[model samples]
Target: MTAELGGRIREARIARGLSLRAMAAEADISPSLLSQVETGKVQPSVSTLWAIVTCLGLSIDEVLGHSPASREPLRVEHPNPIQRARDAPEIVVENGVTWRGLAVMDPNVDAVLVTYAPGAASSPDDTHMRHPGTEYGYLIRGELTLKIDFETYLIRAGDSFCFSSSRPHLFRNDTDAVAEGVWFVAGRAGAASARSAPGPVRDAVDALDAMSRLPRRVGG
Candidate 1:
């Protein structure tokens, strides 16, 4: 599996027209180091892997090959009597932020349940960045400092937020508490969510997204 992962990484890098040296430069590492990584001669730390993947504009799920089920028939994750943690797949960011999802499809939308350890962040810093879509977030527990378009907003448990992904957005949890949240992003690939989400939850989410745009709304 490890070798396969490395092979996929190398394939993705080449498919993007990046040479080993070019990719090394892009990932801010030496060509020798990147070559070792590609050949699985060395195992990259989570942060190093993250830098390589994001630098190539690929999501961890894509790099790890977790976007297949998403392309299959729509799946309804019905409410279970108990929310048992599945050995289901996940994508880790710096080994601190864990994103568990069935798939991370960029075309339809990328929805994930994310958990952050204390002091963890969506990225290293408040770097200005944006996805090609809209974003909706609901904090399940703890608190977070969400920065959008350079403005920081304190979001706590039960708080939700929605905004155009066109603006730069960043997230971090400075509090000494584990934070968990649900994020829904859409608009680039296709209107898949509109067709996949089941009835009540779908309607409720849409309503919430609409209300989030209103002044002083809780969803905002």
Candidate 2:
């Protein structure tokens, strides 16, 4: 249970886009100690836990309140297959990428079915962004490109991939045809502020600070 508590804190920190160092500084704890606590090497005092919770701007009560991950029963259902509809709640995050959420909402992850118009990219301008936890996607009926840091991958229909959300990553549809995919991101809802870069991979405060130092173009 102690280890579970530590892992919960770490997950929340990751989801908040906070690295061990930044969280430690804010919590007035040493980074090494925090790392040890997160790895279950050492137990934290109640005060220490409170400080961490305060710095992360989230509560661990949900994670500690239940052991659902182990004992919770999974729901089984066969709904008339989900179909994309014109009136469905959809958001165009960029010129080419449209997201429509799925019906299922789990505590550990969020689901979205996405449609990509030609030349659509989750990361516009070729800039990378990070998030918390992990990401999984399956190409349902089109081709899409995945970029993690500097590496690029081509995903076609029926192909699925998962990766750490902490790494700078994005998706693009550069083909002539529209593409569709089912996407899942492992993190609690509103895990990070909208202004923050989207991902669950690493310390986001540091990434944002670094981005601020880059020279700005007068106009794109």
**Judged by lDDT, which candidate is best?**
2
Global lDDT scores for all candidate models: 0.62, 0.62
lDDT of 1 at 177: 97
| Model 2 lowest lDDT segment of ten | 211-220
Best by TM-score: 2
For 29-103, candidate 1 gives per-residue lDDT tens digits of: 789988888887888887677667655655556666666444332333443422234633455565267766533
- What TM value does model 2 have? 0.53
Q: What is the lDDT of candidate 1?
A: 0.62
How many residue pairs clash in all the candidates, one count each?
A: 1, 10
Over the full model, what C-alpha lDDT does candidate 2 score relative to the true structure? 0.62
